[model samples]
Target: MHGSAASVGPAAADTPSRGTLDELDLALVNALQMAPRAPWAQLARPLGVDAATLSRRWARLRASGEAWITCHAAPSQVAHGALALIEVSCVPQAREALADRLARHPQAMSVELVAGSCDLLLTVATATKSSMTAYVLALGRDEAVTATRTHLVQHLYQDGSEWRMDSLSRDQRRDLAEAEDSAARTAAAILAPEDRALMFALAQDGRRSIASIAAELDRPESTVRRLLHSLLHGGRAVLRVDTAHVHSGWRSSATIWMSVPPAQLVSAGDELSRLRSTRMAASVSSEANLLSVVWLHTLDDLARYEAQAAARITSVRVLNRAVNLRWIKRMGRLLADDGRSTGFVPIDLWAPVA
Candidate 1:
C-alpha cells in the first residue's frame, strides 16, 4: 500500500508515513523547488544538513525514481512562440498505444490520458504558429486518431514552477533567495542565440555540474558559469523538481475551460492563480477565454473545484472540465506504469516541427 506521504497536503504531525520518502526527502524536494542547481555545499547550510548527506539523500531519491529535476525554456521568454493544448480522440481501443507513441515525440511536451470527451490531452510547443499547425495536421493523418480540438494559448498567468511544497523555513528560503540573486545583473533579459545549446543541455539533466556542462559544450568552465548565471537569473530558463504526482497524494488533475468577460479575464486569472489546487492557468484563444488546471487528492475532487470556481470568480462559466487519467509524459520525460521515469525526449521548442 502507498504510505501517507502520498497523501495530499499532509498527514497529522503524529502520523508516521512509511511512504516512498520521509520528511527529509520532501524537504529536499521543496528546497530544490527554489534553487534546483545550487551547489550541495551552499544548499546544505540552509537545510541544516551537511553537503555529503544531502548528496546521498538526493542520490537515493533519484535512484528510486521517486523524484527528479529538469529545466525548460521559460514560458515568458518563449511567449512569442506557438504553445497550445490539443485534446485528442482516438479510434476504438487505441488510446494507450497512441498516447505512448505521441509521448515520445520531442514537441509533445506533456501527454495525458484523460476521462472525458477526448481520449488524450497534449501540450505542444513549437517555434512558430505555422509549424504547430503543420504538426496538428500531421496528427490528423494518424489512423488511430479520430478527432482533435486545439486551444492556442493567449497568455500564461501561472505555471508549475510557481508551485511549491512549503516545507522550507523562512531562513532557508532567505538563503536560497540570496543564491538565486547572486548572479551579476545582465542587460539582456533573455538568452542570446549562443545560449541555446547550453540551455538544452541543462534541460537534459538540470543538476549537471558547471564542469560537466562545460566539457559537453567544449568551453572553459568560467565562461560556461557566466552564461549559466545569466540564463537562470534573467528568468529565461525555469528549473523545477517534479515527482510522479500519482505517488504524491495529488493522484488526479482536472483541466477547466471557462468563458469570462474580457473585463474580468485578468482578475479571473489572478483569482484562479491563488487557488491551492491550481497547477496551471492561462488565457486561451477560443470560445473559452480562460483555461486552468488543478491537482486533487482523488478523481472526485474536480467537482469541488468546479463548484468553488463557479461561486467565487466573477461571471466565470465553466465550458468543460476533463480529469487527467495518466501522465504518459511530462516535461520531456516518459513515465512508467507506476509514475517512474523510464526515459527522456529532448524537447526543442526553438525548432520548427519537421
Candidate 2:
C-alpha cells in the first residue's frame, strides 16, 4: 500500500496457474472493475476472502504481469482534446519495427498490429485540433507505411471502463456498488494543479492508498484524499483494472466500422455497447459513422457478434472489419507479443506532436 505500481503494472496474475485466469482471479478482477480503489477489507467480504489473502493474490497476479489496474483521463478531464483512430497500410518489411516505434509515442493511447486491410491501427488523442493535424501529417511523412486513413471520434458511447468480467454474483456486485457514495458523482470537472499531480500519480497505480499518495506528495492526507475523491467521483479521471489480453482467454480484438442512419446513430451506439465483447463504441467521422472495438475468444467470434449486431440494430451496415492481431501498446502500457506488460508510457493526452 505504501509503494507504487511502478513495480508491476496493475498487478493481478493467473490464478496460481500457468495458462489462464481462474474463477477466483476473475472474481477479483470483476470486483476491481466495479470499484477499482476499494480497500482490501471492503473488497474481501464480497469475495468471501480474507483481506490478507486477497492482498497476497493480487501481489502474485501483479508480479506475473497477468493483470493490473491503471487510470486514464476521463472525458470530462479531456473536454478540450481530440481523439481519432488511424489505420495504416505498412510496408511488410518495416511494419513490425514501425509498430514498436509508434507505440512509444506519448500521444498514442493505443497502437495495435492488425490483420485484414490495415497493418497497424493507432488510437491517438491530442490537446487541440491543430496538434491532431500535425500528428496526421507527420504520420503520412513516415516512410514505413504506404497509406493511412483516419477516423475522428465524434461521440464516445462507451469505453473500457464499462467492460467487466462476469465472474461475481449479483449480490457481490450490489454490495460493492452500495459502498460507493452517490453524492460524489459529478457531471464535469476542471483540473487544478493538485488535480494534475493526482491524476499522474493514479495513472501510475490507481489502487494506491490515500496515505501512500499523501506520503509521496508530502501533503496532508486529508488534502490528497479530497483531491483523489474529486478527480475520481467528479468524472475527471477513470480507474479500471486491465489484463494481459492474450493470457486472459480473450485472444484477439477487432475494429468494426458500420454505417447507421443519422436518426438511429445514438441507438446503434447504445446497442453496440450492450454486447459483452464490446471494448469501445463510438460515433465517428467517416463513411461509417459508428466505430466499435471488441474483445473476442477467437477470430470466428466476430461473425456471431456481427449477426448479433445486425439483429440489434435494423438499419446498420458493416462497412469493414480490421482484425487486431496484437496490442503493441494497449491504452498506455507496452505489451510483448504474448501480451505481457513490458512497461508503461503515461498517456499525455495533450502532448505536442513530435
Candidate 3:
C-alpha cells in the first residue's frame, strides 16, 4: 500500500485527530528505535514509569504504524560489491505505487519519500558494476520511475545508529583501522559465495558450530574457519550480538534529520560523533537538502545535541524529527538472491504481562 505524502506536523486543537503523539510516547519510541532489545524495566526507569506502563504504551504505538524496529544487516555485509544511493523523480500521482513497489523489493535497505528535487531515496546494494547498471536499467522499466540519479557510496560515510553504536564517548569509540588491521584485509577474500552460504547458515542459528557449518556446506572445518577469519578481518560481517534494552530503567531515543551546510558537513558531523548518547550518525539521500540523520538514546540527549549541533553548524537545516514509536521487526534473516533465507534471527522480546 502507498503511504501518505503528507509531512508530519501538529494541527489545530479542534480538528479530529489524524494521529496524536504524547511526550512519553515519543520518548519510548525513540528508545526502542535505538535498541529494540532493551527490556521493559530499563525503558521504564528513565521515564519514572513502571515496566507495565511501558509495555502498554508500546502496544498502542505498534498498532499505529508510527515506527518499525527491525534488525537489518548492512547490504554489503550480506552481499558483495557496491552500495549506492538512488534518488527517483516521479509524477506526484504515481508516488504511492512507486514507493510501495520499492519497499517490497529485497534489495531495498531503506526508503523515504521527501519534499524537494527528488521524491524517493533508496539504499541499494549490488555485487559489481555490471549489476549496478542492470539495477538502474531495471528501474527504467518501471513506468512510475520516471528519472533516476545515483551516488555510489565511496564508503558508508555513516550508517545510522540503529544497528551499531556510532555515537560513543571519546574513550569508548575505538579506531577500526588500529584494532583490526589483518581482519579487515582478509574479510575481502572470505566474502565469497561459499563463505556467504556458511554465514547464511550460521545466521539462522548462531549456536551452530564451525563443524555444523562445514557439514551443511560440505566443506571442511579448516576451510570454514579460514572463511570466518576472513569475514571478521575484512569487517565485511559480524557475528550475531545478544542485545538488551531498558525495561529495567528509563531510556528514550530519536531519529533526527539535519540539513548541514556543504562546507561544514565534515567538521560538524565529526563533532557530533563524540556525544555520549548518539548511537549512529550518517549522511543520507533526502528529497530535502538535508545531509544527515543522527540517532539518540533519550529525548533530553536529543534536544541537547540538536541545540549544540545547530549552534556549531550554520550551513544547514534540521528539517524533521521522527520519534519512532515502536520497532515491529527486530533481527531476521532475509532471503538471499537465490531465494534461500539468510538465517538472520530477530531479537525476540518477551511479551509484557497484562
Q: After superposition, how far is residue 311 of candidate 3 from its true place, in Å?
A: 4.0
- Please give each candidate's TM-score: 0.89, 0.92, 0.50
lDDT by residue (tens digit), candidate 3, 48-134: 689899878765443332332332234344234555667678888998678656655545544556545577766565545566667
Clashes of each: 0, 8, 45
Q: What lDDT tens digits, residue by residue, belong to model 1 across residues 1-354?
A: 100012122223443333556677878888888778878898888888999999998776665566787777777754656889999999868888899888767788899998888889999988678888999999999999999999999888888877887677888788788665322222235556756778777875689899898998899999999988778767777776887676666778889999999999998998898888988889998889999989887878888887777777859898877788778888777776656666677677655544
TM-score of predicted structure 3: 0.50
- Candidate models: Cα lDDT each: 0.78, 0.81, 0.49
TM-score of 2: 0.92
Worst 10 residues of 1 by lDDT: 1-10
Estimate, for each residue in 1-354, the C-alpha lDDT of model 2 and write its tens digit.
211113343334443435788888888888888877778899889999999988988877777777777777776544566899999998899998999889878888899988877899999987778898999999999999799999998888888876888888989988899664322323555566677678777775678888888887999999998888777778777886898887778987899999989999999999999999999999999998998899999989999999999999989999998998788888787776777776777787666677
lDDT top scorer: 2
Give the number of the best model, judged by TM-score: 2
Note each model's CA RMSD in angstroms: 6.7, 3.4, 12.3
> Which ten contiguous residues of candidate 2 have the minimum total lDDT?
1-10
**How high is the lDDT of residue 50 in model 3?**
95
Q: In angstroms, what RMSD does candidate 1 have relative to the true structure?
A: 6.7
